[model samples]
Target chain A: MQDREKAFIRALVRSNATFGIGDDGVEISNFVVANDAFFEDVHFKRAWGSLESIVEKCFVVNLSDIYAMNAIPRFCLLMLTLPTDFKEVGKLAKIIGNCALKHKVKIIGGDTIAGDKLHFSLTFLGQRQKSRILTRQSIKKGDILGYMNPSSVLTHTKTQAFGKNTKILKTALRFHQHRKIQSNTRFAKPILYPKMLLELNSIARAGMDISDGIFMELPRLSHLNRLGFKVFKPKGDWLYAPEEYQMLYAIPKNKLKKMQNFAKKHRHSFVPFAKAVRGKYRESKKNWHT
Target chain B: MQDREKAFIRALVRSNATFGIGDDGVEISNFVVANDAFFEDVHFKRAWGSLESIVEKCFVVNLSDIYAMNAIPRFCLLMLTLPTDFKEVGKLAKIIGNCALKHKVKIIGGDTIAGDKLHFSLTFLGQRQKSRILTRQSIKKGDILGYMNPSSVLTHTKTQAFGKNTKILKTALRFHQHRKIQSNTRFAKPILYPKMLLELNSIARAGMDISDGIFMELPRLSHLNRLGFKVFKPKGDWLYAPEEYQMLYAIPKNKLKKMQNFAKKHRHSFVPFAKAVRGKYRESKKNWHT
Candidate 1:
């Protein structure tokens, strides 16, 4: 987050003394509520993907927040701002409806309006699972920090492809046989292991989804837990790739082998790249939000 | 709602077989979930009111939905889009925080991002009161349709004032002593009688907030209840005025005396302008959404 945004949120947290603002979602009675905004140009370019893919990505990202809290998404409220010239309203609605059906979430209520840009803000209400809600504030000093990296080359290439020119992807999608790229891009279909994350809830001391990359999230974990991270030779994209949607977790040092076994059974490469240490940690100012 | 928007929502309703999409808010368990968007220019022009008042109106409008459903708003998630050059971040946070505090609503979780225009999408979760939840589908034939019109000339003037050029209001607010206008306008501070509405829940067979005017909302009630409205000599603005934030209710015809007595005790004029009849009702295409 930028400095101004941080200051604004700080003011809000200070003013609302009882606000639990640090978690992915707030727990109220047995329900976890979360919201996220996916605006055109800011979150995605129209030329980069189809509307179906864009809508799917919006759902995936918001649902990730719910899963990170160890809750099952049960209902959603969508606020859509459609452009004036935008047609194909039926297609848009079907995509959303189908997404909700596939996820077993009820389409409760929301508002739709016409505007100059296409913007979507989704609010999801999730029910807690059998285990306790996982949060970023429960890490211990001896916890081992690891992430469930789904072993897929297509996913890696898709994340890398986002930094390239959108014009090339647009042209390729229009003319070339790029069905694989169209279907496999992370922006269109983000990889999320909900079952794995939910099962790991028993062992995860602290956890959150990697939306703004691990480098950006580590400091938050550090600040919340009052400890620094001792890196185990962290490399390249693992540190700075935003919107990974992977689960970053702090596990008990003794439960590392059990967590690894669970991850291995799920075809996920569990990378324990850091350990919680007793020190202050500071991070670079760069982030997905500008 | 416009034809396209209607069609879009119809498609959504059809696709999601179990969706309960007609009410002002959706009831899940004991909570009512509602969402609304207050986009810049679309909902209100910045030149028309102060940022603090603008923010306050946003809260009132969303909370009105909760109250109309016979529930008390307990939590909210805000999705804010801040313009690039926008300042006064601290002031905005304080206003939001204070509004949440005033309504006894917790600021649970939300997302904030920088964009080209100021937009806010608020999702409110309200806890149901002792009375059963009021919805639009329960109005029966011969039920009296009434609205709680707070006896205030300033509110009427404010609704009419929106029709005039905004430049006049802008210039007046800038140079003249318009403190009254600054704080009293419906756009700045909408009038909502939550206590009165909640108390009347026992008698209201059906109810909803008059968001897009009585004319626009009548058809919705008509369609939902499978009955037509017998409007009794509807006057000018009462038919077409939007964003009144007043509760439009369906009361049993025999309970008119009790409803009137309740309104009189609360110092509100309960205007019974219509009755439910057996037929069809159609509305003009013009609405706030366009």
Candidate 2:
């Protein structure tokens, strides 16, 4: 069913589509329309966070699509289906409103209904100058493939927080026991760099926000452009790790230095992980799990 | 939780909002954004009809919101969350695509995910010329209230085909057994008259598509305008019956005749059921049940 779903959606892509089903969002005219669905068990368990964190994450995940296209998000429509037995509807709305306010995205409209499980669908409307919009179709062979590496907070929080002293190790054991709470507080949120990306949009040919891991998205980018990728640092299982809201981009090799300087100026980091190659969707000779 | 949800949404309605949470959709900058959710057991069952009919109904219901505002639908973003075990994904996509093609509305983007239950959310983007937009805020006290009556096919199909005679009654039972099949085929479809409504947009002040029965919508329209309604013919239970795709409007008393003529010319029917009155939010003095 999943394979059939992909094939069906691919068949519906139209010529006017700037980004189709496989990409982060779809662009038409000057606007980008994207919707993301987060289910209870699929995306998060109740024990993972508070209702506020869950609501905030929903906004972040949906807005990430607009940011991936280097577009300025303007408005959002949130549709929430809640279980009949659930409470705290007001808290969820308050958190969502706060998130929207912080991001300057207006909550224009939505629908709320009672269902068997908790589900949220947020549709984001964003705009970008036509020439500045990024898509997966414009990648050329030899363009540098780069990724916004997971932020230090996300990476450090996922590892043990303390080093190897016996006394500290005993205390770290207690802290590690509370790691789930700490991790949810810091790393469950989406990282957005819309303004920075918009400033650098001209330097990149095509890009996508990584939600379904780098391995899955690389083939999609390659399939769309009739090209292949060669990863240089393919020595870890990070290729399959879910990076959620990180982004992958195809940059011209000549502009890599400029982008690096701009990233430094903005205090952002872009790691060059792969390079586009002329072939039929083949990966590098290096194994993904070396 | 339901009450809290309503209160929370009402609190978020901004000053510039033409219609907010309680209305059919929201209007901003000449475009109306609306989203509707249809769930498996709550909206339809597998025994109700074919998958094609279900998919078609989804488009019709979403498009009706644009028609209610006398706007031209431009684009749609669909979000479907289907059970992992479900098949027939391709057929669902095909029907949705055909419906969009027929309506001249572009299916720009969408998301499909796996969920525990079957759910579909459609966000419609529609536009109206600034002068042609209809909103609840413009309704006047003395305006005439009108509705697009449910078509004969939707009405008569609800009653027994045979009125009198034992011979006919025996055959009617067998025919009635098949009525569910027929009703699902014809009445379950959404009826849209966007072009005609756009032509008549000037005559209407405030309007909304009737999805949650006329009785329910009447109170909402009245509450929004701080006025009341007086129904002339209040003895029928049609007020409570779910007329999924009909429209209700507030027209000026003087323009009622012109609207009637226009409806005739367009092969549409406008039934004037009530009048806007200066009072608190109350229904007609006439009883709803005879």
Candidate 3:
């Protein structure tokens, strides 16, 4: 399936499209269009989460793609296929409506049908200033690469604290005592701040959201730009773990200080991890002492 | 599921979107966004058709929505979920690519995943000239309602003739001798001619493609406009049967001659079936002697 996915992407590249398959979304003139699918067993197990949490996660997953391109998500169309036994139709609508309200995106139109299993797909429409749109193919040698560390977004202890303090998280906390299950709700939620991306858009040369782990995404960036990546520290399992909603980006070496200042002003932790070089694609296995 | 589908659509209507839930697509600025879903066992059986036909049908289904609005479909994004046994991934891409090429619509970006069943969802992005876009809510009393009859698109004998002559349909002809099976491929295809719509766009008040039967859709239009439809002839099974790619439109009574001339110039069959009047929604049960 992975190889076929690549082949499918390569076929589309010949169409002279503005963005490649690995990019968060494709840019058409001023509009950015993208879609994401969430299946029952592949993406979520009905026993692992509530219906509301699953629906909310679906919207956040699609939004992550739009935000990765430094674009503002304006509208969404949903396609849902439900099993015959599923009867929470009105509740599902309310949850989706609430999510759209929170993000200020309108639910324009969609199709609904009955099927064997539950399937949720959302297509998001967004826009970015012509000068601010980002792509992964623009990286150059000597550029500094950075990533939004999963630990920086929310650690297990912080999630537990938030679950104990907030009323919404309090309900999720009662489901299990283990840290993994307790933090599941927070993990499903996406931390999106489009304003921060807009602020760094001028300095960032290339960017993509890390939905398929850092190792998988780094190779894509390297392959697209025909350059190699040299990570500073890469000994931890976190480097290879699949983390959703985190962003990986490349910045010019000369703009590192400005990038750091912008992150500090926005209270975001942008960790620099690698540098692009003229060589075959390879990752550092040892930790750096910088 | 039908009740829930209605509930979900009603919930979205509260957002004050540019178009209603029953319309083919929603108008956002000058572009229209729409989506449709096709499930494996529900919409098609793998043993009954080829992969190329299924993929082509998916594209045509989405295209119908764009054309119903008198809009030009410019771009598409696909989200596919396949079972583990499905291995026609590359062939699927080639067929979709060819369809997009034929329609001049670009394949932008999409997501793919493995699931319990084969699911295909297509999202279309289209543009409409400011003065040309039409919507169902714009219908008025005394407007003449017209439809592209299923027989006009392709009849059973015509489909068999096409199947016998075209190399592509020869493979489909081997499946079953039933006229239903012979006409299935043609039914899956969409008849989109934007030039004809452009000619009628200045005068057509409201329009929609009929995926659900005419009997079901006519009431929706009447309910939306707070009017009734008086059908002249409605006894044929085609009137109550669900047709995939036919369109139903409302043209001003004064513009009937121009609409007829445009349809003839474009080599299209536009059949007048009903008229808008001040009353509750109802359908004629008897056939008319035209």
- Top DockQ: which candidate number? 1
lDDT of 1 by residue, B134-211 (tens): 888888899999888765443545333322223334444454432434455554567666788899877889888887
Q: Pick by TM-score: which candidate is best?
A: 1
- After TM-score superposition, what is the CA distance of residue A277 in candidate 1 from its true location, in Å? 1.5
Candidate 1 residue-wise lDDT at B40: 84
Alpha carbon deviation, residue A187, candidate 3 (Å): 2.4
Query: Which candidate number maximizes lDDT?
Result: 1
Candidates 2 and 3, the one with greater TM-score:
3
Error of 3 at B141 (Å): 0.8
Cα miss at A202, model 1 (Å)? 1.9
Off by over 4 Å in 3: A11-20, A150-156, A159-180, A184-186, A282-290, B12-20, B150-180, B183-185, B188-190, B282-290
- Considering TM-score, where higher is better, how would the candidates rank from best to worst? 1, 3, 2
Report model 1's chain A TM-score: 0.89
Every candidate's lDDT: 0.79, 0.67, 0.68
Output the lDDT of residue A95, model 2: 68
Q: Ten consecutive residues with minimal summed lDDT in candidate 3 chain A?
A: A160-169
Per-model TM values vs. the true structure: 0.91, 0.85, 0.85
Which docking band does candidate 3 fall into?
acceptable
- How does chain B score by TM in each prediction? 0.89, 0.81, 0.82
Model 2, B181-263: lDDT tens digits are: 44322235555667677767777887777665576667668777888888886545446544346667788999999988887
